[model samples]
Target: MTFSRVNAARGLTLAALLLAASGCGAKNTPADASRAEPDPLAKLQPAQDMAAYRAMSDLLYKLDQEAIQRELTETGQEKSTKPAKDKLFGFDATRAVHDRDFIASGEGKALADSLLTYQTPSGGWSKRTNMSTPRKPGQQFGTEKDYVPTFDNYATTTQFWVMANACNAHQDSRYCDSASRALSLILLAQYPNGGWPQSFPLRGKYHDDITFNDDAIANLLKVVGAAAEGDERLAFLSDGLKAQAKHSLVRALDMLVATQVEVDGEPTIWGAQHDDETLEPTSARAFEPVALATSESADLVLFLMTLKNPPENIRKAIDSANRWFEKHQIHGLRYRRGDELPALIPDDDADPLWARFYDIESDRPVFGDRDGQVYFELEKISAERRAGYGWYTERPYKALKEYRKWQQ
Candidate 1:
């Protein structure tokens, strides 16, 4: 049934029950929840622009959802036999839809039903079907032709945020339970040094191949924020999220502090750190830091401010990060030390974060390398390859504009 239909029916059923209750168990009716209202989220219910927001959110949500469904179908039928190569992704689409209340009318739950079909025994989702099954242990590789699971930590993070948010809207415990398990996996996956590895098997096995940082931690933090404060898992929940933000922030800050190239006596963050092993900043590639550009740092700063008595250290760290951001933003974009010269990476290869940060103000979609090429490899690929690809095909300007609307 549609969301409105289900909700309306549920509402009427409970009302009829309350009317019939007379003197018995009236406390158990929907009125119980209603009396306990004053919902914290009432203000967030976009009454004024809600219709517009819902329409826009739904369009993107449906498009992304179709891709996710396609991936899930390709994973093979688990009830029969496992496909040789089975990978699943595209959860972000569900998440965006859920958060925007596209599911409020119930259509979103239908999409979510497909996702639940792929859940693993451990409560966490495997990137591909037949993943939980015993298999040879190593970095499994597969081509586009094969359904190899992509083992990125960000995928798990996205699942938590998506599922957790869904649970809130549906008032269903299953989504919350799934979210908790995914969150736990992330906590367990943290390295002794406090950073999360980029890929899965987040243990001693593939220590050599892990580097991409900020995005995963940012995603994790957003999911953790979705949890209710008084929930039973609050302690574990808060600790894990705070630890992620704290440690990861420190590591990121250290990198920024250590390697921010000095141009005209000002320190600036670079695009990607260059280290073959562990991908630390042994060298720097001059793609600009993008998130800080569109006031992303400001958003995080605001989120941090919402904490009741935020730790002094956390506040201090945010302050430092903010200062760096304020100093870095110029002509409405964050660039490497000497941005007057071309970026260190090719234009197409430019960091997406930069587009995100600036909301596509100046240099965006593709930041030009000294040689005038874009940093994104996808941009370099033939137009045929990138044509229908969701992310690659999304120009930075358009992506940022859509995101800005959502934030509103």
Candidate 2:
């Protein structure tokens, strides 16, 4: 099907399914009619805009429900599968292709070949898929419901790295061809302003936003930067591709500097995501609010510091972000992870910690819950979030340590 046609069909299907499930247009009994509950799908009215619709937590829950219902309808039983022996295809798998001998080995060849089968027409791999198993005919490229080719969770960039290394070791034209296609996706997905969306083909909502979450754009920059600098892993790239990579690298760096949040005309850190057009800090998941994100900002600063002889603007951006880190560092408290619940314990000699999110104007730490409520204290959130999320981090210390060396 044509892309546009497919999207339109998906919109119709989802809306029909969700509306029916939500009791929209359904006959109401006298008792039901008297009880007056708000429509559950009210937040999902803009279903035509896939990005916006997908960003709503309610819609996501509904999508999962639909998937389960479809599975039960088709098979009349719950689908069961064996647990994986080791980690499936993910960032770790991408990092595992480092040894040249391994890339040339028989096992490595098999893994690389499997990756080729999984590559979508968009020239990117999907996240959390099992590339160990070859793609079945007519199987969807993405394993996740409603997810297409994305850069999120170190997807395409990592696949490209594997392909490039495999090409280098095997001297295989097919590997080189695959690497080139992946490079094209990276180039095509970049916004005119030099930022990258979490997903390509413009999946709507925060996925359409220029994302720094989980080092999304940073990973893209690394791939292109290597290609531009003639890194041996990507040595198969043509002169034309290299030139394009160089241009992409320049634009991406410019976007990074431009997106740094400024409060009262003084530069600070950045949010995990930014609007593609406005470049303003934006929210992503329900628990992720529009605020200065310390972990992502720290990773960004570390990447920037790697550049040799940066311009004045880049230097200034780094310095200001470092100051913000220093000023906001939490003292006399250490975050302790417990079996039941995590807690912030008071300890005078505790290493400085940084909150995951901070108020843009006040610089005070903030917390978010699944209900979309913002809290000033970590204890105020749900137990699941407190136990599952990294509410406090020492990541800024690494950046600060690197910055000191960079200054010297």
Candidate 3:
């Protein structure tokens, strides 16, 4: 039977016991955790577009989350204790934490407990907090007075999925309750214009922008879209939540359509960030310019494609953006990093890669560095930044694939 309902009390108890028996209980004190050193991976910070790791940001997380689910069905075991070669987002990356098939196992219950420990009053999680790491045996995770919930760096997005998975692994009210709180947090964070800020309860600066950079808006839509669609993963959500999700998604869709950057009054793609009110392209980090963001807009297009029956305007939006991606695609270039510098080298056999940004006016590919200088030539940026950032990605191909399938 599908673990759709949130009635996992029996499962919860059983799982709780199993967790304790398995030495995964919440007994370790905060002092025990305090002594533990941070994982070395947590220290690896990118110089630019830290949240905009192209192949990652959201795609890799989405894929790897599914990959773990697929593996559980085949192997019927918990994830490997060994490290995953695959990249991760936020602090979970440091742990290579796989969202395993834990419904029947108590693993899901224990995991949900971990999530609950970290959840804030806003009903969401803060970014870069470890999701895979269990708190020391007895200490709560989010008791640190400063744990503010956010949508940045896969914050609320990751929580929703983890809770949803826990609910599915076994009916757990806490899991569903946490997820519902997250849903409300997400819903409340929306601007009237259908855009989402990077953080909720409103922090200043880029936090308030209509963010597509790092796929924050896209991830919000993914969960809200799932609930609106009455997806089984979120079957426990009430009809009211579903309706709220639907209405929110409908409004957000309009926001997306309205936010597309236009040239000559013809819709093109979108920018990484947009003004919350005016909806015009806005600058995010200095390296991220107010331009047609091929990456973010592409993900947004893919999100639109996921809708079952899109309105004409949405289909048109997808079509227009597809045209932009196809037009701006870079050929004969491959990015390869080595111990030596000059990471991106030309390869005659290289497949196509899309530039991260485009000049909204000139319609030419543009690159930027930490010093806030935008360059036309790929080689102009310093080597440290050139290697640290994702100036290119394979995301556009998904839009093309989805578009072709939609046509069919």
- Per-candidate Cα lDDT values, in order, are 0.36, 0.73, 0.65
**Candidates' TM-scores?**
0.43, 0.77, 0.73
Candidate with the larger TM-score of 1 and 3: 3
For model 1, the superposed segments whose C-alpha errors exceed 4 Å read 1-101, 104-106, 120-154, 171-173, 203-214, 225-279, 282-308, 332-408
Q: What is the TM-score of candidate 1? A: 0.43
Error of 2 at 117 (Å): 1.0
Taking the tens digit of each residue's C-alpha lDDT, what string does model 1 give over 1-408? 134654445444433432332222122121111212221111111111223222322332232233233333444422223333444453335444446476443655554444444432122344443322222211122212111211243455545555655666676655555555555444434333333334433222222122333344345445444342333323334354445434544443343333333334543322222232333332112233221222323344444444445555555544554444543332322333231332223344433333322212233344323332344433563443233222221122333343344334
Specify the highest-TM-score model's number.
2
Deviation from truth (RMSD, Å), model 2: 12.8
Score candidate 2 by lDDT: 0.73
User: Across residues 44-154, which tens digit of lDDT does each residue of candidate 3 receive?
Assistant: 111122122221122212322333343344456554222211133224421212445443456556556666655543356665455455533222233221224567666
Cα lDDT tens digits for candidate 2, 96-133? 46777777888787778777766654457777776775
Off by over 4 Å in 2: 1-95, 346-350
Which segments of candidate 3 are over 4 A away from where they belong?
1-100, 133-147
